[model samples]
Target: MDDIVRQALAKWPDVPSCTGWLLLDRRGNWRMRDEAAQAGGAAGTPIRHTALLAFINRNYEADESGQWFFQNGPQRVYVELAYTPWVVRLSADAGGALSLTDQAGGVFEPSAVYVDDEGGVLFVDRSAPPRVAVLHDHDLEVFSDHAQLADDGVSGAFFWRDGVALPLQAVRRADVAGRFGFVVSPATRA
Candidate 1:
């Protein structure tokens, strides 16, 4: 959290949280969702302004309940996740290292990897407050070069270059929330 945001929160102390106005798309785009977009099932407009994107990314965070939100100075604006709270993108400049891009476009190092039955890849960052993110399907091919389907024919494992094979679960996509301890969408703070 930013010091300025903390000061604002301390000063105002009662601004209602905003919801469904911001979205993080599967492609790592920060979208600005309006009432029309929310009603019409639109994915919101992609945020293009560099300064605004950086501001949003800087204030993005999650609660104890795993609901992700961005601190709009004092007000908490919960993010509508298009996929997962974090979206993993390949960092070409880092020699194709797996970069975990959160809903706000911030990056983190992944400490663990998981693959579901549907070939969905999830990563865990063992930070102070651990976070789990999904690898975007568009980048699966890039990850595939370093992974393989295990002989079970139902699951796969990440073949780390260090010669370590981390086994992953084979769960249905719908079961991901329970298996991962997160809500896909929150009706209220959860």
Candidate 2:
């Protein structure tokens, strides 16, 4: 197994067993939403969403977009949702028409939700050639090099916000092996 994955597993044994999804709403607040029961209507154990939010809030600063990191005890796991190019079929009744798009586009009409192996649903837009919709589907792992403590005594990656150098620490270590940091955003921090 990858070192980061092994490390994450060692630290967070319950990760794989975690079935529900975690969300960062438009307000930049953290919320853990549980998945509904299967065919039998048997619900899985529910985790305290508030508890997780409080935990991340205390450890990391919430940006304007409400972006935050995830931590398991002492190890920080960077959790991010990524958008992938996919084709969606509109008007599925008659086998529908197909269009390609990413996560930024709005919803499409008469589209079938395709759940990938990773439990992420693929949203497609039939109206446009490229469909767009924000997807919080995939669990992307990100890591950081050794961080130096800032004036606040927090260790995080150094970045510039509004032209001022800001200290950003890892709230979540997405990588299990911890080799390289996961680059979730299109823009580079450094």
Candidate 3:
């Protein structure tokens, strides 16, 4: 959390949280939803401001109930997630070593890899509460290159650069939020 935001919270501790106003899309874009957009169930306009994006990323956090939000100074701006709480991009070093980086620019080392029925890849880090990050769609090809399917076809293994093959488990799209302990839409919860 930012020091300025902490000061703001101390100064005004009773600020009501805002929901249905901000969204984090599947592709890792921060969106600002207006009244019309919220009413119509639209994705809203993408926020392209670099500084604002950085600020939001820096202060992003999750509540005990698994609701993700951006601590905007005093008020908490709840985030509506299109998929998982985090979106990760896959990259390879010069020696063909794979690394994962989240939308917030934080480097993630996944403890497990999962593949949904729809073929979407997800990575889970070994945090206390655990964080599930879906691989960005654009990097699917790169991910496929490092994966090997088992004889059953449903299971597989992901070969990391260090020669460690992480077992790929199967998951259902509908069970993602519940299994990972995150809320997809905070507006509905609110």
Candidate 4:
């Protein structure tokens, strides 16, 4: 949290939270959801301003309920996620470490990995309250060695991870919201 934001929060502690006005796309891009776009059911325009992007990245964070938001100075502007809160992009370095960067440009490591029924890559770290994240579909090839389908023709409860065959937990993309304690759309009025 920024010191200026903390001061604003203390100074105006009764401000109402805002939502449905910002979005974090699957590729880790921040977007502004304007009223016109909302009326037409369009995903907002991509935020391309470098300085504004940097500011938003610095102020973004999550609450205890797992609702991620950007502290726009004092008011909390919650984000609507196209997927999970954190989007993992593989680092360009030779080591090929998985990079979990939040909507805000923060980075962290995942303690465990899982593959959903639809082949969506999942990750989590339960050490300090669980935080679930998903790998961006476009970047799946970068971490191909970490997960795969079983050789069997059936898509039953089975999968292979890191060369070890294991039973598939069979998690759905929609169920992730409740199972992982995150809201796909953190709305102040919904």
On lDDT, the leading prediction is: 3
lDDT of 3 by residue, 1-190 (tens): 9999999999999888989999999999999999999999999999999999999999999998999999999999999999999999998878788989999999888889999988889999877778999999999888988999877654889987678888999999999999999998885432
Q: Given candidate 4, what's the lDDT at residue 58? A: 81
Candidate 1 C-alpha lDDT tens digits along 84-125: 777877443355444456655566666677666666778777
Better of 1 and 4 by TM-score: 1
Error of 1 at 68 (Å): 1.0
The estimated TM-scores of all candidates read: 0.84, 0.23, 0.95, 0.81
Query: Model 1 off-target regions past 4 Å?
Result: 91-107, 151-154, 188-190
lDDT of 2 at 32: 47
Off-target runs (Cα >4 Å) in candidate 2 are 1-20, 37-52, 59-69, 74-190
Q: Give the count of colliding residue pairs in each prediction.
A: 0, 26, 0, 0
The better candidate by lDDT, 2 or 4, is: 4
Model 3 whole-model lDDT (C-alpha atoms) = 0.91
Which residue segments of model 3 deviate by more than 4 Å? 151-153, 187-190
lDDT (C-alpha, whole model) for all candidates: 0.74, 0.32, 0.91, 0.72
TM-score between model 1 and native: 0.84
Candidate no. 2 TM-score: 0.23
